[model samples]
Target: MSESPSSSQQQPAVGADRPPALLVNNIEVIYDHVILVLKGVSLEVPEGGIVALLGANGAGKTTTLKAISNLLGAERGDVTKGSIEFSGERVDRMTPNDLVRRGVIQVMEGRHCFEHLTIEENLLTGSYTRSDGRAAILNDLDMVYGYFPQLKERRNAQAGYTSGGEQQMCVIGRALMSRPKMILLDEPSMGLAPQLVEGIFETVKRLNEEEGVSFLLAEQNTDMALKYAKYGYILENGRVVLDGAAAALRQNEDVKEFYLGISASGRKSYRDTKHYKRRKRWLA
Candidate 1:
């Protein structure tokens, strides 16, 4: 595999002055006790900042998120190396519930809402880890509605019947109900219309600005992810191949040619050249 660019060749991490909300330090993941999935991956999401984890499918983005949220156990995956920290506390070994209560939540990819539950009920489930009593949960429920007015309209409707955009809203609104300090968002734009995708990203920006909720967004939509994220890390085959501030990454020639489908010659097809040639160029 190609090595990531040296630190001197890249911009400093975004919000480096601020304390990090979540830190994954040189971690590795293995599934079924045999197959290695992540190779010494490391990144940081600063307090109240948005960072995008950009990669195509199977590039290990979701696995990285799962490792941070401590959700790998369900899939028989284990973090055999390195550690993860949240709010200055080591949380790699924490339970998923513990992580949620510690203000870390993951809205899993594919909008995993409870099909049998009403939209409102589905949202209420997010508050299950809170012990701050009913009043605060109800207050946050209303707060979620304020961010996603569409959910408020369909509060009584069954989640299974809701539109894909509405389901996406429901899941994110659900995460908000948990009052997270940092959210590991997986593919917020999947299966949505372009307009809806933009709308979702706009709401994410608003949440970051207004609520001060940091985000580690794992997404396949490189263009949209970079557009909204202040900084980004690009993963390939279980490793971070590139990382930088959003504007810098947008202008990087390697990024433009590969991820964004643009080159100095003009827009190009990723399949126009052999995969190894592309890898060799990145390695160079």
Candidate 2:
């Protein structure tokens, strides 16, 4: 009932069976020497696959990204413990540029494009590491433009003048110019309209399918994230509480009720339904 991977498709997953694209082990992060933001979080992204980190606000999802990118210091939060391995190398202590050189690029929580620069200038900045410099930079720009043609038409415009959705495209395209193997997408659909959300997800899917770029996406748009990713990890209050195959998690009654609202059990748990409560409250 299923087709196994073809010979050409048999590379490695992020773990032992086949080395994953990225491996984030039991990591903890803290700020102010007391406030822990990430509590022993662990997840991985297999090569060319998408992994979603889902949770409510304040769930530590963004902190997890900052930890992986070593960008936590901007806010004084440090990766207090644990390690990150990317493509078989220990990466936790590396600088942001070092991580980018290692093919791990983060799009950041706010699509932080250079607003004062023209769209093309902002994109050229993404290829700062390339030896070919400006020429190769243009080639990468073409590739990015192919994905978001609207950006091409606005190439001469100041990035800040673009609409929110277009600005998001510029940020992602800027990251792509770095030619990364995997990307840490903070929240591509955060403030987008439903129509624009569909377009962004489609572009992400295309990039993954056509370019073999792996992704570790952290998003509150659970529906879209789950749609594109193969596996998922759910976080709450600084810890992961649920993780599994995306399809399995999507159908989980409790997950549907609590996260997606596809079930009517949101008011009560399977363990303490009315039937059980009537008979078992005293047991507690």
Candidate 3:
């Protein structure tokens, strides 16, 4: 239910010259030969802007990210219809590695870092596809380190030994190594402290403001997600039920009640009391 702004009322007040960086049009996904996971979902991410896929659990957020990243295979999952285009190049049928090579990377949920490798080694793995990227990789590492300096200090330490926030940074740094035009970030704040979630969101902001990297992030952390994103689409029952500017969604009472959740205290409690103070020691 994306609110289509009329020609006279375009949001964020964009001009007519530039096209969207990523365009996913009426895509359908099915799994296990019979079950449908996505129902003709369509969306767009303008270049250098943050767009959020906002939803509760089981709302097709991850599925939408996976689908656009061309990680969906028929044997596993299939985009039965529609197309995904990046800068006007058709990409939905491509392989995951191919997509990465073409500068499309997905930082998956749960901070999928290489547990056995050192933080430096884990970050280096992100540039595996680049043969002579050592110098540029170092620069990128420096950039990521500058954003989360904790990673720089713990560069040579074992990735498995780091805390959740650091692991999330490593995963994001790994994706950035690919020099992606747009990164598909799935649940960057799924399981972390509130402060760390704020830090991660700030880093995402810094990236967009400084490097002009585009992002399409899916998150259940609606309060933070809408804050980080400029435009948002709310997913429900495997379909987009609401879409608008982040500021608009933020003020929408129904969105706050149903999707974003009424109690911000729950988010704060899980972050402050549980792992917030304890996890930062090792991470810092």
Candidate 4:
């Protein structure tokens, strides 16, 4: 198994030959000019690769995604340190709209579809930033529907009335409408049943393979994230405590015990007597 990188060391580039789709280097995020949310976080998504940002709630996953997408300003948060580059160009200074126009789009957590709009209408909004003409937009819309055939069935339904699973699909289809080269997907499995989660991930894999869209997925579902992602970084209180190839991370004793609820003996529980002690040792 491959060794995981320590918090202080940058992860070695995944696909060294291809330029990265996204690069975040030692970034710090400060909110309201006083609260430090992210501390020296860094990661990369190689072109056409899927990288998972795995962590428990409040581990700074969303903040990291916001930082990359330049959505921090709205929350009075700022990337106070380091640089973010897309396709080798500095983009931390760019506006979120500009970032979207440059082929980087973020599908935010909580499936933020417009309640009053039809599912198709919500998807069409993603193409608003494009000037590539109606024919291209319509073609892309067809492409999104192809990937999400259920959305096609409910194309005219109001987003407010859709099921959680269909709403999830709608949001992703909306992002697809932008024709993004790289997508920063935050918590794609939240608030869904297990079967739906599996379906969503399978579709994500298909999109990655067929559409060639690189993904930086932020998720609390570590097991599922590792199952689909090629590489992964585990965050603890805003810092990357561990990172490695997915298979290596799955095999890691620390990851198995703390994250996956498994150990050499058998399945483990957080209430185990040595839980905190084990956590301290892993973080150390």
Q: Per-candidate RMSD vs. true structure?
A: 3.7, 7.9, 9.4, 4.0
Tens digits of lDDT, candidate 2, 166-213: 999999999999998998999989888989988988898999999989
Better of 1 and 3 by TM-score: 1
Provide the overall lDDT of each model, using Cα atoms, as 2-decimal numbers.
Answer: 0.88, 0.82, 0.81, 0.89
Local accuracy of candidate 1 as per-residue lDDT tens digits, 13-87 = 665478777878778999999999998788888899999999888989999999999999999999999888898
Q: Of the candidates numbered 2 and 3, which has the greater lDDT value?
A: 2
Query: Which runs in model 1 stand beyond 4 Å of their true positions?
Result: 1-12, 267-284
Q: Which 10-residue window of candidate 2 scores lowest in summed lDDT?
A: 275-284
Deviation in Å, model 3, residue 247 alpha carbon: 0.6
The whole-model C-alpha lDDT of candidate 3 against the native structure comes to 0.81
Kindly state the number of residue pairs that clash in model 1.
Answer: 0
Worst 10 residues of 3 by lDDT: 275-284
Q: Rank the candidates by TM-score, best first.
A: 1, 4, 2, 3
Clashing residue pairs, candidate 2? 13-19, 13-20, 14-20
Model 4 scores a TM of: 0.91
Instruction: Tell me the lDDT of model 1 at 110.
Output: 97
